[model samples]
Target: MQMHKNRPKNEKHSRTVMIRILTCIRPHTALVALSLLLSVITVVLTLYIPILTGHGVDQIIGKENVDFKELSAVIITILACIAVTSVCQWFMNHINNKITYRVVKDLRICAFNRLQVLPLSYVDSHSSGDLISRVITDIDQFSDGLLLGFTQLFTGVITIVGTILFMLSINPYITLVVVVLSPLSFLIANFISKRTFAMFKKQSEARGELTGFTNEMLGGIKVVQAFGHQDEAQEQFEEINRRLSGYSMRATFFSSITNPATRFMYSVIYAGVAIAGCFAVVRGMLTVGQLSSFLSYTSQYTKPFNDITGVITEFQNSLASAARVFELIDQPSIAEDKAGAVRLQNPEGHVTMEHVSFSYVPEVPLIENLNLEAGCGQRIAIVGPTGCGKTTLINLLMRFYDVNSGIITVDGQNITDITRHSLRAAYGMVLQETWLKAASIRDNIAYGRPNASEDDIIRAAKEAHAHSFIMRMPDGYDTVIAEGGSNLSQGQKQLLCIARVMLCLPPMLILDEATSSIDTMTEIRIQKAFEKMMEGRTSFVVAHRLSTIKSADMILVMDKGHIIEQGVHEELLKKGGFYARLYNSQFSAV
Candidate 1:
């Protein structure tokens, strides 16, 4: 289950998310300040047009002949205001976009930087597709909504205030009438907005699930086709895709209705104000020009209701994206390093585990009270059936995971007492599953030892039996591999990984089925190289092929998270225990 499962579905959470967004915006203070100042100028200039038009109307009222000079001045002033308003509006949009995009870039960088420091367990538990969505898709959606909401949000506020003040100066009674009916637009918008927030949240979740499914399918496309499971995979993808479409439809439908509904109510308010103004005009209580200006003010005041309601509609989607992003940022990570931690330098690789116990979850331990030790420069080989905790032992030794009880130590000092960087740096590891990024072969080989010389990188590759195929390529060492090195064979990728570890040449080595992909003939040929690399180094080997581990200094047979047998190869066979049975079962088949 995801930690995001019990999301805070309350107003406080939404407010907090918005506060975070504001924090991002606040960093670019000059841009936002300028945008807001332009917005105010634009709105004030727009409101001035109506006031001038009202004065022109009063001048023409009850006149046998028009005052040409006054009329010309009124028209000139209105035109000048429109031109200035256009310029201010243009600058306001430019500044808003600059602030919005800069804020979005900083937010994405923060999310990516957070992932770099997060513990490995959190990465293991979460879906890759969902994290990608939060970093890429969700941030884009959230920023877009923020841009739309804020741009109109500021202008809408200023228009409302300016219109209200001008209307009050003209006639407070009519202004009050407009004010009372304003809440009707808000009421309808509130009713619709309440239903939309949850719908958008669900839609965002379904989108991430669909994205996850697509990534999984593509990454394993070869297996899916080889096993003839195409139809099954297609069915599963369609199910998730259809679910995403349904949630999107519901969210959009609710958002779409907000603008039209608010406009409908505004139109009703407009009609009522016009009728009331006519009576005032006929009774000589208000001038014709004032009535005309009052009608215009009524329209302007009511228009903001529609703009604000539209913001309410779009805010739902932004809120949904924000919640997902925060969920990832809020996941509990493994405890940080203790203050004043020690660093291990030139470790002798004297590893020991005493009463160590651990589990992926509590109450059902995977390794319980297991005790083990390996002297400096001893080669330890661990053999077991699937799920017998062979790999779990190595994980504990490296402190990839901390043991629930008991301690693991190196060179007589507790592993936890050392800085993680210094602790992990002591061991050179090569796993069964190879990892290669989109970089030159030489760069990948020298990843750990970045300052390694060209001659040393080639020497390591030659020892690992990877030099011939690499040289056959047109670009040789400079050839860039695609992500995952899809063009390379399984054995080739594994050999490259081995070459990487050999180049680093750390104090200790861990080979987890390291060369399982190589053929028996190839393995026999590379045995000399393996012997050379493991010389005088504490090496732990986890191999399914019993032949590869026959010469280990110490052989451990594990079953159900316990050490079932321990001895040299000949002695273990003499006992005819779990180790003997496992070894004989493999050779007998051959």
Candidate 2:
């Protein structure tokens, strides 16, 4: 996989970021509004308890005489409000969690769908591990921030605003002191928040790197052991782990500082409010009940500030995840089918490449103005050294990558003018690496045709000469193979792949070194099966074994992306050219 060396850094808190996030929530606006309403009720109930306590104190001091019935009603009303608020809080949390889950689900689906439409070049340039991290880990981080941090921030803001308004109505002098301390608290929070944001971004990036490293290591463990590089791999893992630890520590330390600084600032503000309240009480500027109420409001005002700071820290972490996700979503896709692109219907297997020029990268052409033609049902064999553009030829024929210059056609229709889905659906491919999922042998065979019946799967398997061996397994066709068919032999896996393509029954077929891994004996046994499978289909083979393609209708011997010779086996042998030399080398060994 190609590595992206320069991932962009998210340095500023842009209004655009907030706007994008809000756009994701557009579908869930109703739920968000309901949650906001519940948050309001929670804030109101939270502030009322302190006021009710102050009233009870006044009643006990005989300053505000209350009858038993009125006192009982007030107490019951306060308690009832608290209970309702608790219920509303639960309801809001449920809605928040639900919305977050749905949003993440939608985002993941969108990302995956976009991946499908993206070009093979794009996928080749991005690591599988990094892409997976963006889809899974980053989206989850966004969910966490939305569900926990956003909820707290909303409730805190409402509480702070409501408390300030009530405190001013009770006693203006005390409210003024509380208001002055707000900026100091904010300044401290702002400083810590910036540091936390930077650390958190690093921490998230480190996590993705670690995940990619671990995945690469585990996937190639056999290679590591065979090469005796286990220690090297271990050291690499240790380095990544240490880096992750350093970033985590920095993020945690900054996150930890925010709360304490907030608490200290709150303490200083409280001391000042207390001193001022005492003087006002002595001066008869405030009543005991009013002073007590004012003090409660002042302390509660800091609750919102603390809550906002905490939420801000969490939002910073979540933004890191969002940045990764957005990067993927914003990536340019391969050119799509044009406005009037038509689907190929019942395509003839005739294929032509005219003056084709192509490159995986600019300035390094893999194939240059190459021309070739294959009639319907013709078996074409391509022979070349490694990296001589044989596979690149197949990639272009399959439309996995478009040519830089020139045209490829199916039945006289330009492939570029056809829908990608329709173009690919016309061909069946058996790659060198036969990838089998963790599924039953029957299911694996039916993968090309999900709705195919049991009999159809059995027929395809039988045609590929896989049924006899599959029947010998403990569960026969029902036997489940490990991922990548680890439980099966290489020949067995190749046979399954052949069976899958046979099930698809496309008019055109590609065999990309498909039988290279199978033993000589298995190859001999399956040669007839392959011949039968190739019958009446336009077939293209990238040959590793010269004998396998000796019977091909046309053999194209290639060197350095150019066709050096093209003829039937006997005709090519008579020419004494590249094909003749290749045939002599393989048969000379025999």
Candidate 3:
């Protein structure tokens, strides 16, 4: 039931998100500027047509001397302007779409790159599904809302201002009513918008939860099927789906109320305009043509308010998404590399933990001032009961988590003084849970050194005893592996992982229960490969199999995060310590 910790929260709404978003569009600023100019022209052209119509109506009704040719010219000019506006609108739409796509592309890349630079702890504490939702869903929402809302809001404001100014010039009294009603429109918009924003925030959170559930369920489908828990999973999924549906409905319902409520207020204002205008026309306070123009202007004025209100709603929704996006972007990054931090060059891979104390969380210390050291070219085996901090030691050595107290050094260089990238690059790791991408076997094997040639890949694979099996497959090295190497046997998968680590050819190697799941024959094959790979390299192996570490230069038996015994396998056995007891227990049973 652990939730993702990296989930975004709305802290404060600043122009910062928009500013950052606009920076990505700076390359397309020319196109954007042109689009904005065209949009303005379109609004102007749209407003002028009503004035032309009013003039034509006056000519026909009041003068009773319709200059048909002049009227035709006016109508044609209006039509021409309409055509121009349409063309401009089309171009604007194209530019906006292009800018939006580019911005989103940049945002995605930046977000992904930032994710890479973040520490392992960040990834460990977050769910892949929730992060995926932020990158895919939240960004998509921002893109959709931004493009539409920017254009509509700009044009709407211009139209509203232009119409109001024209109306005031013609009939100040009627304009007064519109000016009074505008504030009321804004008030209603603000009220509805607050509700919409809340609903949208809830909707976004629900979506992340739903996505996380999908990822977890799909990733563990094999386990679910093995346990015959499909129905139970379905029920759990259905419950999540129902909750998502309810939240979505609430958001939609609140959003739906905005348009109708705005329209209802506009309707009242429209009725008032009609009645007031009619009275003015009858009393000769306003001419028929003037009244007609005023009515047209009133409609134009209302349109922008309507448009603004709609944009406000969209803005609210986007703010919800932006809150999530910014939340991730603003997360306190892992300790950054300091200026002038020295690089560990030609590392000897002689690692030492000096009174290192650490914890994943504050309450529980996984490694308590644990002291250990591995000389260059020495093979160290760490054996312990499960959760006795064996793997945690490796994690610390790899600098995945900084120690709460004390220091870890590699080749006399404090790990904290070196860049994480540089420090990690010096080590090769083969984890117990081998992770293979859905790619060709050759690609998987050569993943550690992407530029490695076919010869290099084959050499590495051959050393791990994986080359023969790979060649015997349907497509040989080109055969595609399934996710997590599901198509291969566990032993074969482990061998491939070893081959990948071999390709890296680092001076330090970590093998975390790498041979635990393999058969005896495969284990023997890999054990030789590991011994060969560990040659002239500082190596740490965490294993339950006592035989694997019998030849290790040093063996440390750990219990409850403390190293209780240390020596060569025979030396520890002669000492009759914890290591001896564990070794005897297994051999005694056999």
C-alpha RMSD values across all candidates: 3.1, 3.4, 3.8
Model 3, 208-298: lDDT tens per residue?
8789989998889989999999999899889988988887788788777878888888888888888989998899888787888888888
Compose the digit string of candidate 2's lDDT tens values, residues 146-245: 7766578888888888898888777877889889888998998877766666677778888888888888888788898999998999899899889989
Query: Candidate 2: how many backbone clashes?
Result: 0
Candidate 3: where is the Cα deviation over 4 Å?
Answer: 1-32, 62-66, 285-289, 482-489
TM-score-better candidate, 2 vs 3: 2
Candidates 1 and 2 compared: the better one by TM-score is 2
Candidate 2 residue pairs in backbone clash: none
Q: Which pairs of residues collide in model 3?
A: none
Error of 2 at 393 (Å): 1.0
Rank by lDDT, descending?
Answer: 1, 2, 3
Q: For each candidate, give its TM-score against the true structure.
A: 0.93, 0.94, 0.92
lDDT assessment of candidate 2: 0.85
After TM-score superposition, what is the CA distance of residue 3 in candidate 1 from its true location, in Å? 22
Backbone collisions counted per model: 0, 0, 0
> What lDDT tens digits, residue by residue, belong to model 1 across residues 66-107?
777898999999999999999999889888888888888888
Off by over 4 Å in 2: 1-14, 62-71
